[model samples]
Target chain A: MSCLDTIADYGLRSIGIGERVLPRGDGIGLCEQFTLIGSGLIWNVYFGALALLFGFVFATALALAKASPRAALRKPAEWFVFVFRGSPLFIQFFVTYEALVLLPQGGLHLGGLTIPTGWVTSAWSGALFVLFLNTSAYAAEIFYGALRAVPKGDLEAADAYGLTGWARFRRVVWPTMLRLAWPAYTNEAIFLFHATTLVFFSSFPAYQQRGDALYYAKYFADKTFDPFIPYPIAAFYFVLVTLTIIGIFGVINRRLNRHLPQAARPRLRIRPQLIR
Target chain B: MFLSCADPSALSGLNWLICYLTTDKQLMFYGSFLVVLLLLVVVAPVALAFGFGGALAARSGFWPLRMLGKTYTAMVRGIPDVIFFLFVPIALDQGLEYMRHKVLCPDWTAPIRQGNDFLVCPAAKLPPTDASPFYQESYGFVLAVIAFAIVFGAFAANVISGAMNAVPRAQLETAEAYGMTPGQVRRRVLIPQMWTYALPGLSNLWMILIKATPLLYMLGIEDIVYWARELGATKSKIYAYPHPDWRLWYFLGLLVFYLLLTRVSEVVLKRLSARLARGQATMAGEALRKVGA
Candidate 1:
């Protein structure tokens, strides 16, 4: 088949929409690289989108727990963030995959109902869980810094207005925490997308050769013995995805800080030195 | 290995656990942890030196040398490191062999890159195809270390260059005015002052290096991850430790080891940061002064 035909076949193959079998022949072309890796971007988006969504809420809670005076809340949150942030995501993937494997082979029995534990073995569940915890630790750190940075005057103003407890946090603390955290949160999102590259690379197997952008890129690299083409294609897609993440997160950050005078709103800067 | 528990049949509970943990393979597994630690200890300083040299070269007056340094620093940004991890070792091996092939097999005219195979004179093979298993493994480990150092050194160069730039111009100017030589100024003022700025990025890089250690397994090193997978895979009924696929627990153990290492590093780095900030010309230093005053 022509390269165009190959594209039509495998273009949407990553999400199981197109050809069942992968292309294996003389050599993979630019079209094949573009299509297959693009197909694999489906997985990258799945991981990045869900992880960011869940990690945001969880990370806020973690930030609160970390900032709280109560040792009960603070200690666990501190350790949780410490453990996740301290280690490599690759190990976390292996640990999670292994832990999931050790789960009772038959689904865990609860009140005569079998809760599916096997799903954890799939990249969707296993890798996502690791990403969730990893991003939460990172975002928690950002949020914690932002929480500290929420101007003392803002809180004093809240107190002056007779705001207390949940009312104080919701109206005053929460928005400010988000606003201060937004730029760093944007960095975290970019890294999170970059980190999605590690999912298939880790112990979490991409079932049936169905994997992410890096996975297919790696596959073609192995098959063709050519690193030049496949890896750059993967990198090109990732850079685009990373820029898109920055763009989208930047918009949300603009909206979050729209209440502030433009000068006061934090500028979203891309400084992701940390990939994991 | 507790030899007192001589009988596997007599062992139970805690004693059984101790015996199992101390098995020969487990000892090898423990040894791999040391391998990881050694790689880190060796690679960090080596990579830092490489980075320092690269950064200095980039800032050098010579045009082509500066471009070379700049390119080395910039290369890491867009590429996935795994590509380098895979390509570097093989290429290095082939490159070495090719050099040896030219020297050792001058009379032979057959092309080295015949078809897909990278053929070389048998005498030129790295670690020799007939070498001991230990030599082979060690060769692979060395290659992995070199690859890691190359990648991480570029990252360190970026951080170090930034740190160097962050050192205020006034410091250098004052040194220059004082009749200090350029080398003297750099050594006395620039390097020392740049570190406190570099510490944060360097510490982050250190943690990343720790995380990246597990990729040793990918490079075919018999690292803890490799051992974990090997020992954790289901053993037959005939084997001493018959268990279900316990690779997850082994991996979890590796994860905990990394986490603990990172936690310790975090504490150490924080203390170092505090120490570095004590009299520096930063807001942190000013805060320390306020507290003291």
Candidate 2:
């Protein structure tokens, strides 16, 4: 078959859209590797994008709860963040997969509603859930730090204007917190993308041979006994994706800091440790 | 092992539980935890040393050595480190055998690469191809450690180089003005001061190193993950334990172990950070000063 035929066959293979079976043996090459791995990028995007969007709101609440004077609210948020952040993501994956398996084999039933527990075994569901909690804890920590660093003058201004409670927080406190936390949040975003590679590598089975980029790369490496080729292709793809993420976040960062003078705007330096 | 727990098949209730927990294989499963810890303690310093040498060489006056060091450091940056974890052991093994083949069988003349096979002289074979299982296992573990050290060392070099730059130029200038040589200044002042700046990066790297330990399973080492899978699988009635699939519980136990490790490290590191902050000129030190006031 032609290269286009191969692409057509495996292009959406990750989501079970096209080919029913994976190509075997020397069937792998630059074309097959690029096409299939790119297909698997769908899962990565789905997990990263959705987890980030949802984690944003949850993290904000977590930050607020952590900063609250009420011990009931503050303590739970603190422990949640501590437990998630303190552990390695790899362990989290194993624990999650096993937990999902232990759930009643059939679908869960509640109040006459049948909830789908089958998909929980998937990388899309299982790994995404883990990544969601993991990022929430990390982002909550970042937001908490930013909340602490909200300038004393800003709070004083809110007090002087008699703007108490939600009014004060919405107008003054939240925006500044966002500005301070934006850079670290961007780091969290990149790390989430990198962490997506762990999805298939963990216990979550890549059903119907639908695996991520690293999975396909490893597949080729094992088959060809040549690590030099497929791995660099995967790396090149990741670097491109990483750079794209940086570019998009950099734009949001610009808008967030638009009120500042040109020199005062923070530059996004690539911090290596920013990714767990 | 409890002596009363001998009859695993006949026993029931808590007695059966005690017998199941004390099986010889279960003991080996527990032993893997120590192996993981040993790998971490052994690998971290070796990686740091490699990183130090790499960073120093990259900054060297000699052009070739500088290029080599720069390339070594940059090599790991572009690729997913998992690639290196998979590739390094095999590549190193083959590379060593190739060198030995070239040296030991100088009189023999044949291409080493023939189809899928990598042929080497019998004298050059690693573990002699008939070595004890212990030799084979130890050799594999050593190779894995070297691979981790090489990859993580590059990351450490990046951190160290930045930290070296973060140390104020004024300190070096003043040391020179005091009639100190470059080497002497580096040894006495720069090295001592650079650590305070490097501490944050180094600590972060240490955590990453801990997380990366799970990749040891991929390296063919029988790590905790391997044992978890082996011990946690469903056991049939024919077996002594005869338990349902408890792999999930085993994994949960592993998760808690990691969480505890990280929690303890955070507490210890916090104390270390406080110790490092003493009389230092930084934002944290400034906060400490205000607290004292």
Candidate 3:
């Protein structure tokens, strides 16, 4: 088949759309590999974007809780961040997957209504849940650090302006914390996306062989025994996504620092989380 | 391990638990934890050495070496490391085998790529076709270590090179003015001073390396994750010790293992950083000096 035909066939293949069966063996052309892998990237974007979005709010709460002086609030938050940050995401995926899988196969029944538990075991939700918690922990730690690092002068200024409690937090504390954390938060965001690749590699099985970009890349490589093409293709796509993430976050970072003089603004440096 | 462990079915309470824990597979599970420890022990220094070389190369006056070092850091930084973890071993294996194929089987007719399969000559197979199981296992492990080192080394190079730069250029100039050679300046001043800056990054890298050890399971090493799945799966009535799925517990144990490891590392690293900071010109050193005074 022509390259365009191949694209038409497998373009949405990773989502169980387009082709039912993947092209096999040496007969699989680069076009099919590229199209299917790119299709698989939809899941990566889905997991990463959703997790980062939700995790952002959760992390902010967690950071606040951790920063709180009350032992009741602080202890749990500290332990949560420590446990999640200390362990590898790889094992977290397995542990979470196993726990989810062991849940009642039938949906949970509350009175007449049923809440589905089965989907919680699948990669779409299950893996996403794990990623959500994982990113929240890492980001919470980053935010907590930033919250601590927020200048003493900034807080005094807020107090002097008669801002207190919620007003103080919303107007002064939160913004300063975010501004301080923005660079590292950007790094965490990139790390989360890169980490989305591990979902399929984890215990959560891809339903119907539909998986993320790395999964499809592994599929092509296994079939072809040629690591050269599929991996670089996956890497290329990831690099593209990473660059886009940098661009968007860079804009936010600039906005965060807009109040500061250009010379005083901290530049956005993409620190490798090699932590992944 | 206890004498009473022979009759597991007749046992109960902690007695049965003791018997179950001492099973052969459980022994292997315990062994795999050490495998992780071994990887950390070996890979830390190996990766640091690789980083040292890459950092020095980046600082080299030569343009080509500088480009190579810069590219190493940039390339590894951009892509998810899981790709390298997956890519390097097979690529290296294939590359190694192909070299052997060229050297040992010059007259071989078959193309190495046969449809979807890799067709290496039999003689070129790593550990040889008839090698012992021990050798084969170790060979796979060595490849995993190399892969980890190559990827982490690039990150380390970034840390180390940045640390090198963070050491004041004036210090090197003073060393030169004192008639010390470039090599002597690097040894006495630059390398020693860089540690305070490099420690935090290296400590973070150490934790990451600890976390990444579980990826060995993906590379087909029968690691803790492998053993957890195997032993924790439903073990119908046919076995000596029957049990329903207990993977949640097994994985929790693994998580605890990692938590403890990370905690210990954090404590040690904090001490190390303090030690490195003492008697230096930084804020930490100043505070330490005040305490001493």
Write out fnat for all predictions, comma-separated.
0.41, 0.39, 0.77
Ranking by DockQ: 3, 2, 1
Docking class of 1: acceptable
Clashing pairs in 3: none
Q: List the global CA lDDT of all models.
A: 0.84, 0.83, 0.91
lDDT of 3 by residue, B45-119 (tens): 999999999998899889999999888878776799999989999899999999999999999999998778888
Ranking by TM-score: 3, 2, 1
lDDT of 1 by residue, B112-224 (tens): 65433467888888979899999999999999999999988988998998899999999999999999999999999999999999999999999889988988987889998
Check candidate 2 and list the clashing pairs.
Answer: none
Report the poorest 10 consecutive residues by lDDT, candidate 1 chain B.
B111-120
Query: Which pairs clash in the backbone of model 1?
Result: A98-B248
lDDT of 3 by residue, A1-276 (tens): 799888888888888888788888656888888998999999999999999999999999999999999999999999999999999999999999898888788888899998988778888888888899999999999999999999999999999999999999999999999998999998898889989999989888888889889999999888888999999999999999999999999999888889998899998898877554
Off by over 4 Å in 2: A1-5, A19-21, A274-276, B61-79, B104-128, B285-293
lDDT of 2 by residue, A96-152 (tens): 888888777778889898887888887888888899998999999999999999999
lDDT at position B9, candidate 3: 91
Model 1 TM-score is 0.90
Better of 2 and 3 by TM-score: 3
Give the docking tier of candidate 2. Answer: acceptable
Q: What DockQ does each listed candidate score?
A: 0.42, 0.43, 0.79
- Give fnat for candidate 3: 0.77
